[model samples]
Target chain A: MKADTRSGTGDPMDGFDTTIHAPNRLRICALLDTAGEAEFAVVQEQLDVSASVLSKHVTVLMEAGYVEQRKAVRNTRQRVWLRLTPGGRQAYQAHLAALRAIVGP
Target chain B: METDEAIRPTPQQARATLAELERVQASTAALSATPWPRWFATVLTLYIAAIPPVYGGMTASTQWLLPKSAWSTVLVLATAGYLALFAFAAATWRKKTGVALRLDVLPKRATLPLAIGLPALLIGAVVAFRSTGQPAWLFAASGIGAAVSIAFHRAFVRLHRKTA
Candidate 1:
């Protein structure tokens, strides 16, 4: 997380996490924050992005330790579910706060 | 090299990002609000409504309906069946919406009271019926339980929309 020194808003950027700053990654965090957990295919569909594109962003998030994946066998098929780690959720929330601050009331 | 100035977004960019995030959240909310199958509510209501009478039957002095031993079995089967139905509903919802139905998503302010009040109502009714030997207590509890289940379903849909 980086402080938004540019704005001089002392405490506002405390949650500004650059790891979640990318557009698709931000959207992913927003969805996971709301849903708690969502299937990968569902996320890909909801985001309306190619699998490769979504996977690329997901890999970045995963590497950042912001998101975790769960693999399960359901309906005789393997399914991957994605959710934010606790730290990831905290970082995402902080980023949201920072964004709101930048946007003002 | 990306300068600090280049790394930070301007206010206008922040506003745009916030708007887009809201759009994504709204879409997720809409998906979550997908209506449960009609039977979901029906089964839930039926299960809740059945608890008191079934419990009363198990503990009642009179054994006219079934032997005292049989009521326990009935209660267990009923509970197992309800759990199975609940699991099925959750699985189907996940398949349909690609999002799992999560009770934790609901506001604790609302769910906490429900978690406590519902069981209290049903169990209280059972205790009253056993002490008084009145069928009316069981009937009243059943009706209220069913109504509460229906109302909760409606409230869940409304809450999702309001949050969205």
Candidate 2:
């Protein structure tokens, strides 16, 4: 393996770094960034994506250390909650700031 | 001791913090996680019941704005066209936002509104008691239409969720 770059780099976002973040991932990050934390159901509902598709994208983000997911029973129903890690938040905010700067007048 | 430091919220800082809070609230509203079905029922009940009396008041107030027949015709047609356009818009918005219209529009939704929804139904009742020959059943019908819309809404939510 290429030094498991995620573990090797001490940078907050070393593992989660991406040169070409896809639209869906970016959308997820934007939604998560603003919401702080959210339920899988709600996220799926807003994004209008299939559960499997969302799960796949979320898994990629999780693998990249950009997300955290937890499972629990709420009101006798199984629910999944998600929040971004500090590294995830930092990366998203900086990336967003950079994008805004790029589009600045 | 009394001449202590002044703790003040600078206008610019207060505005920035308020702006951030409003943004967070809006985002949470967009992503409200409550089941769309219940949200649908509650919202449709409240608004369908609430809107007609206001429209009627507007219609009555504006009666002298034109002749009765012409005015009523224009008003009814305008409102109907607007409602249809609104329904179309809501459906399209449901597609775009990936949630039921009601759920997509509110912050921290709950089912308590359905009980309150009944009172909203009686707004037309109160209007009927005040006005002569008002079609009180119109209110009932409105409530029924709202419930029916919930069915369509749930389907859209489920379908959108599947396709998204």
Candidate 3:
């Protein structure tokens, strides 16, 4: 991940965690942030990624305490729902702000 | 393999990323714009439009025919029915939209102006009815208000989707 080293603007780059800087990870965060929570399959379908690939990114997010998962039985089938933690939401918002800052006025 | 660390975005790339993110958000929002809610909102508006007359008719028509307590019970039941419908519609909406009720953009857009204008218009109608003893005017005003609100909602969705 590229560190924000621009010294003068002081746009709070500290909130931009490297964990969420990945392109796919950033997209996942963006989706969850807006949807609030979504079924795992729904997220995968929306992102158009393989199950394994989605799981890998989700695992990274889970490890970082940025995401949580719940399992439920829907139509007699187990379904996983994914949502961002409050901390995750804060971090994502801050990261978007950092991105905006990087893009500049 | 190009890992995330190897794929840092330049300023232009960052702009593209943000644009994509915004597009994603917009698409998610659009998913929630299904017709069920629109129809429900229209019905709810019409239901609200009917409330005054329904309650007034219950009391007026039943004044000599039934006990006062019975009137209260019927009014309570009618009000409860409306509340139950609202709750059912809201719950169904949450399920179908896969987003919380607060994130409902159409209602949010329609509500702000409606919230401000609705009370004033309703109160004005009430004042007019009380002073003039004409009940039809109140129903006419509320019915028109409800229709306008539905029209405004459709217009907002149409414009919003066009922009999106």
lDDT winner: 1
Q: Encode model 3's per-residue lDDT on B19-103: one tens digit a residue.
A: 9998877776665554346767776677667554544444453342456566567668767877888788877765565544543
Residue range with the least summed lDDT across 10 consecutive positions in model 2 chain A: A11-20
In candidate 3, how many Å is residue B32 off? Answer: 2.6
- DockQ of all models, two decimals each: 0.47, 0.04, 0.39
lDDT of 1 at A53: 96
Which residue runs does candidate 2 get wrong by more than 4 Å? Answer: A1-20, B1-164
Q: After aligning candidate 1 to the native by TM-score, how far in Å is the CA of B135 from where it should be? A: 0.9
Comparing to the true complex, what docking class would candidate 3 get?
Answer: acceptable
- Residue pairs clashing in model 1 are none
Tens-digit per-residue lDDT, B70-108, candidate 1: 878888998999999989998899888888676665568
| Docking quality band of candidate 1, CAPRI definitions | acceptable
| Interface C-alpha root-mean-square deviation of candidate 2 | 15.7
Cα miss at B72, model 1 (Å)? 1.0
Worst 10 residues of 2 chain B by lDDT: B1-10
**Residues A1-105, model 3: lDDT tens digits:** 233443335544555567888778888898888777877887887788999999999999999889999887766988788899998887887777767766876
Which has the better TM-score: candidate 2, or candidate 3? 3
lDDT agreement with native, every candidate: 0.83, 0.54, 0.71
TM-score of chain A of each: 0.86, 0.77, 0.88
Which scores greater on DockQ, model 2 or model 3?
A: 3
Residue-wise C-alpha lDDT for candidate 2, range B10-123, written one tens digit per residue: 345434433444454455554433334454355554555445544444444334334657645655766676577667665544434433345322222333454465455545
